[model samples]
Target: MKTQNLTVKAVSRGLTLALSTMCIAITSACANFSGIHDDRQMSTPEHYTSSQSLPAERGHWPSADWADQFGDSQLSALIAEALGGSPTLEQARARVAAAEAFSETATAKTLPHIDADNALTRTQYSANALVPPPYAGSWQTENRGLLSASFDLDLWGKNREALKASVSQTEAARADAEMVRLTLTEAIARTYNRLALQFVLHDMAEREVRNREAINAIESRRVASGLDTEVQHKLAQTRLSASKSKLVGLDGSIRATRYQLASLMGEGPDRGLSIARPALGMGNDIRLPDNLPADLVSRRPDIVAARWRVVSLAHEVKVAKAEFYPDINLSAAVGLDVLGLGRLLTAASRTASMGAAIHLPIFDAGALRAQLKGRYAEYDGAVARYNQTLLTALGQVATQIAELRTTDVQLNDARDAQNATRQANHLASLQFQTGIANQLTVLDADLNTLAAEASVADLEMRRRDRQIQLAAALGGGFVDASVAHPRNTPAAVAAR
Candidate 1:
């Protein structure tokens, strides 16, 4: 065998992207990048005590089993089903799994890697080349085997920063999944409450239909006896028709709410048929925690996810900056090349090489700078989204609380009006039986009672729905234990 055929040549060292010393010199003389720096910083939010919204209190943050607090087993079961089967939630989980995979790859980049490679092939040597013997003009079988090992030195912390960015991204994905869960549960609860309200109103609609029928029948008899005109009878008939139409609308509404509830659960329309009427009790004990706006960062999943994105992008900015420096790596390889398979196992065929390599972006015509700028832009966008989500979350909580308070007062008034109307209708009936009041007066009183009852039902549903909204605004029982920048409020940063 010839010398060239007996050994293998390996490129194990040198600065990457620079083939020779001349290339490095040329690249060094090409561009000046001292001004390319990312100086944008993330914003710190203002932290306030719980007294900003309400007085400081303990045992107010929603618990994991907050759904059960509504005192409805069916609602709990439905929420459980939705959590387990929701396609939206499943997509969120898939994103988390992908993030975890990326994290694994990033972590692997920081560690040493070793692998074995082997190959068997037949090749014809060139007859007029550097080869000197019988193998020069003949086809020969060659066997090759090698083992390689490599590790990055991470001198500029590029790999380390990349790993951190991956980990932060994974955390953000996980928090996003939690946000989906919170949203899904809240939607199901709200839809269920709507269904219940429709049922209550449906009953009222039916009652009005019956009352109209009675009035229409009385008007028919009065017209036939020449005691009332056709106009009066037709007006009563029109009222009866209108009441029946209302029942039709309410029946459709009940069905529509059921369909909406089922869709929210990620199920077919038929699944709505299995849903029973809601028997939910108000979760009056649920309230804001003592450590609010300060602690809220760790409670709301959207806010937490947004903050994690900011953190991840911040690390990416570091990684981009590190890219402007050199990447140092160590590599080693041992291999044997022999024309005869039997000689592959012999010591004469053994070959080995080891060296360190450096990869530096000496010249790319501003590619590195562009990458760094892009990373900073992404980081800034994440910061903006985090701040916006924080503002929106606090606003939602406050709005729900205010709306619930108003509903409470309105509910009380509605019940009072309902009671008074019932009394008035009862007194009107008594007067009619004693001939002190006309039938029209009694009928008017009954109509007023129906209207008052319907208003009370509507308000009651509003109150319950608002309570659910408040619970949802309170993070729907989801709390992140891993608080990012919990101590880095504006005040703390200013003090620092």
Candidate 2:
């Protein structure tokens, strides 16, 4: 009777110790809960700091068909193709999948784990063994099967905190994938614009060569008639040669840009040679809405991804802090056991057992606290990066807006020069036909007009490039899908 009382008292003491450890862990976790930094307290600006007004938008923040605004069907198609084929996007997708799988694993840790086993054995009993006399010196056969299950009590919410961290990481990964897709589309558009500019420049160089050749023919005829000096004829030949050299240089540039575009599309370099020239004209037809939302920066994928990372790290800190408590688990098993296979399934031959376990980190040497501090440091870093991305996005949009305005002024000047040169060339042509002006004057006028037109073409390309940059800065009209997790969706400042 005294032994039985002692056993009961020992069990009661164990249960009390476990409960006390659990209470301490809970208190520690709660004390650390408010340690996570909340960025939402920071004041969000109504408009870009660099600009008072943002560019006009039509339907959405950045229209879904922003590429189509360039009016180049080929460019639009190429962007679509690059998005579908680019390895960069595929890598992002794989990362997202991996993060999601990790989240599922963390969630599973919060639930019970179950397993089953079966075994058969034959053994000979020794005569001096602690067994019945009939079985002491004889061989025996036994059959057994068992099912067991175990679950962590999660008394300090450690498992739940771990699950939350994993979910945030998964969302961050998805946002990273969106960022990759945005970058790929922007690259394809920019490359296409560059390729088109090269084609246009090449055509301009060829036309200049032909015009110079025509002038050389005229100068030669004048020299043969003794009306022009040998020095003058030599000058004409030099000009023609220079024009041919320019055409050759432009051919090299065109080929190189094509190769770059091919690599971006995930195709062989030679594939770029088969691409047709794209027709792109510059104009500012797209406009931003007069009212820009305060959450515009939230649409940026980098910002969103960084925000999610901070959230994940915050939860990780909580998980680390939770480790200050004890870990408790319960397990049980029930199975049939018999000396003979025939009686293995009988109720009388059954065997069963159950157990509970508890482990408190008595001597970890400050490892858990160090890990929690590291998590806090990581959270702080993510917040800083998120702020930086926001600033960068704002600067890009403002710079692009200023550039577009400046380029518009430059375009106007170019148009005026082109018009003046066109008229001069027409007048020179009339004078040459009537023998009032030399053929040399007409050729000079032709060259000047071509130069003016090339300048206009180059400026127009810059305008198109600025438009693409602005659209990319504005997040390219991407919308985040709601995640099916604890938080449902990330906060707005870190997302859209």
Candidate 3:
């Protein structure tokens, strides 16, 4: 877009006109119109608190490169793929582009506008018109060309305020895109974690089945030798069948989760089945800071987006208020007016005019007032949403922290139980070999050990799940660099 700077005199004249119009409108409505409220509905707590044990160390704000902390190269690659290719993220980027274009449009309004015009026509005068009968019945050819320029002096700073509102909207759109990126990364990590857990469970089920087969073998030998009842052998066979069934179910789960992971990475569903499974229990442990920063709430993208919305609507309210004044427009034109094309360029055929126009809203059926009222309501709604987003972010972080701590306690207990069961099983095996324990007692010890192993594995999965949730709750290390420089997140980067 082309742009031209405004002069001091033009600016001053526009401002004077705007102020005088606003004065008249305001004074006339003094008895009927009430002023707008300055207070807002949302407030924030200075600090976050929990009803459980204090953390040994407080968590720090996540870094922009937070996904790397997971320590899984495959996961990092997957996240990058999703960020670069996901359709949802693409839509967000498109919205940012649209907002940027709108901002440019608003910016253009504050600058000078110029146009080149030209026209040629042949016409016959009407006989019954005011023109003399001799010329009235004659045909005439006319040629015209003109260069026109106009500018809306931002009187009352209305146009400038409109530009500000557009800028705020652009910022909001960018924050929204960042939010989508963060969410996509978190989803990929969770799905990958679940896929790994499914593999662990599948392995566990296989081992359980082998254990049941061994038990069945022992029971069959005992029954054939008349040392155990037929009922005992049948029970062992039933246990073996149950273990096999569980293994089958776990296989199906693994396949389903793999498909989900593939979709998250922006690939075909079957692509997940071919993906290499990352090793379990390899994720980096994110430590909580001893004291959470109050400003950490601002790190959340949705909160930032909501805040921008409030700013945009606040500007919109000003724009609406400015509408109460007259629209002051300055336009000028210089062109040649001639009867033939050959004379169009002659200096003597030139015509020129320059003037300014004022459109006062003497009567608009209260339309301007209604528009201003709507803008105010929108501004209030935006404020409330921003407040709600901040509160939700705080609550999520708090809940995740508490759950992480509880998981640690439960994991410790599970490990202890596994150790005890292992020792007990070893003693029972030794006693049976030495004829001090019955076969049923030895079998019971083995079963208990198997159960204990499964319990430990399940707890480990839960612990991993908690860690994932905590990372997401903490914004997963996303940073909004675009807030400082809109060009930082270029369309080219998003397109890639």
Candidate 4:
């Protein structure tokens, strides 16, 4: 009895020591968890500098109705249709919704989970000679029902970090959707501009063909009257044939452009959609800003997406570091054990128990540390990628600005050349009518004038295309000061 008593005392002492060690371990883990930095302060970059100035408020492009800056209602309608019906945009929006769902799932982890369970059992027992029994034979029934609830305390901030990561990813997805919308808008504008240019060229080709035909008729009349040689008539016929061939080619180009625009608008390739020719009016009244502001980069969706990705990676780093600490879990359940179903819920038959669980990593052959190192590398890669994105954005803005300036000058020169050619052609035509100039001189002057006019048209179209590009580089439209976060209108959200 003395030995047994001593053994009992030893057992109690061992248990106390075990409990003390466990408490120490829990205390150490809690301490490690405390020093973790809040994500808001850590995830934001230490310095975010815009490489270039923001686009000025008084830019040539107006903030409202960027599409209407071209003064073409048809073009604006096409842009709207593409934005509304684009499959790519829809896919982007779906990704945003999916990310949002994932974020919600992460958030749900912080709440307690409740569950219900029920069980029924039946058993038969037989009496044995060596055992005393109350009855000769007995049948027993047992029933149990339980409502269990459990929660993790998140002492390590693992769940919070995961939630933040998911939220950042959702923001990135939203920015991606906006990027897609902007790209689609730019594509539609470019296609529309090309279509307009092609139509103008087609008209010019047809006019040239008509002029050639008239010259051919004149040459034939002159030859019949013995005033022109066969060589001149043959030359005029050759010019007429070339003009007809060019006209055919232009028509084919026009058809091809229309088909391409149709496809962009989510229609079948052969769908009949005719684009009207843009009105020809020359005006240089548009005023471009001399200096851009610095905050324009942040307004760009792609740049915003890059920034979000950096934040997401930062959260990922936190999540990875969390693996170094122990995870704490708590569980509890209350139920009953009974010989009959009717007594299952009675006080005499009821039972309850609770437990706390902890999992700590003492040794893993360096695997956990290796995984942490890999995540750190990933974070570094993300940082580099984010910086690269900023540089590329700056490069794009600079290129657009330089091209816009150079094109402005080229457009001015082209207009002057067209005017000079027009005046020269007029003088040559008058001289020919009065027999002061040969048909060859008039033909040369007319050809020069036609060439100059075509150059002017082409330059004008290029200038407009550049303007659209600049608008796109300037963040599609203007950034609304009121829109601090990503926003979807009621209609937009409903459509999704």
* Most TM-score-accurate candidate: 1
Ranking by lDDT: 1, 2, 3, 4
* lDDT per residue (tens digit) for residues 105-209 in model 3: 999999999999888889898888887866787888889889999987556578987998899899899989988888888788777877777777788788878
Instruction: Please write out the lDDT profile of model 4 over residues 98-176, one tens digit for every residue.
Output: 9999999999997888888888878666775432465336667768777787877676677887887788889889988
Tens digit of per-residue lDDT, candidate 2, span 1-496? 6996697668756865766666675654432333434343222444235336564456356766788877888888878888888888889999999999999999999999989998889999999979878999999998889888888888778899789889889988988998998888888888788888878888889989999999889889999999989988899999899999999988998888888888888889998898788888673454555444345546778767876787777677667767777777877787888887788777898777766787667656667666767776776677677667767777777778788889989989999999999999999999999999987899899999999999998998888888888788878887654421335323531221
Question: Which pairs clash in model 4?
Answer: 53-293, 54-293, 54-294
| Cα RMSDs, all models | 5.1, 5.1, 6.3, 8.2
The digit string of per-residue lDDT tens for model 1 on 14-68 reads: 3332334544455455533466554444444354223555545575877767778
Candidate 1 wrong stretches, greater than 4 Å: 1-52, 55-59, 484-496
Highest lDDT: which candidate?
1
* Count of clashing residue pairs in every prediction: 0, 6, 7, 3
Question: What lDDT does the true structure give each of the candidates?
Answer: 0.79, 0.77, 0.74, 0.70
Clashes of 1: 0
TM-scores of the candidates in the order shown: 0.89, 0.86, 0.85, 0.80
* Model 1, C-alpha of 333: deviation from truth (Å): 0.8
Ranking of all candidate structures by their TM-score, best first = 1, 2, 3, 4
lDDT for 122 (candidate 4): 82
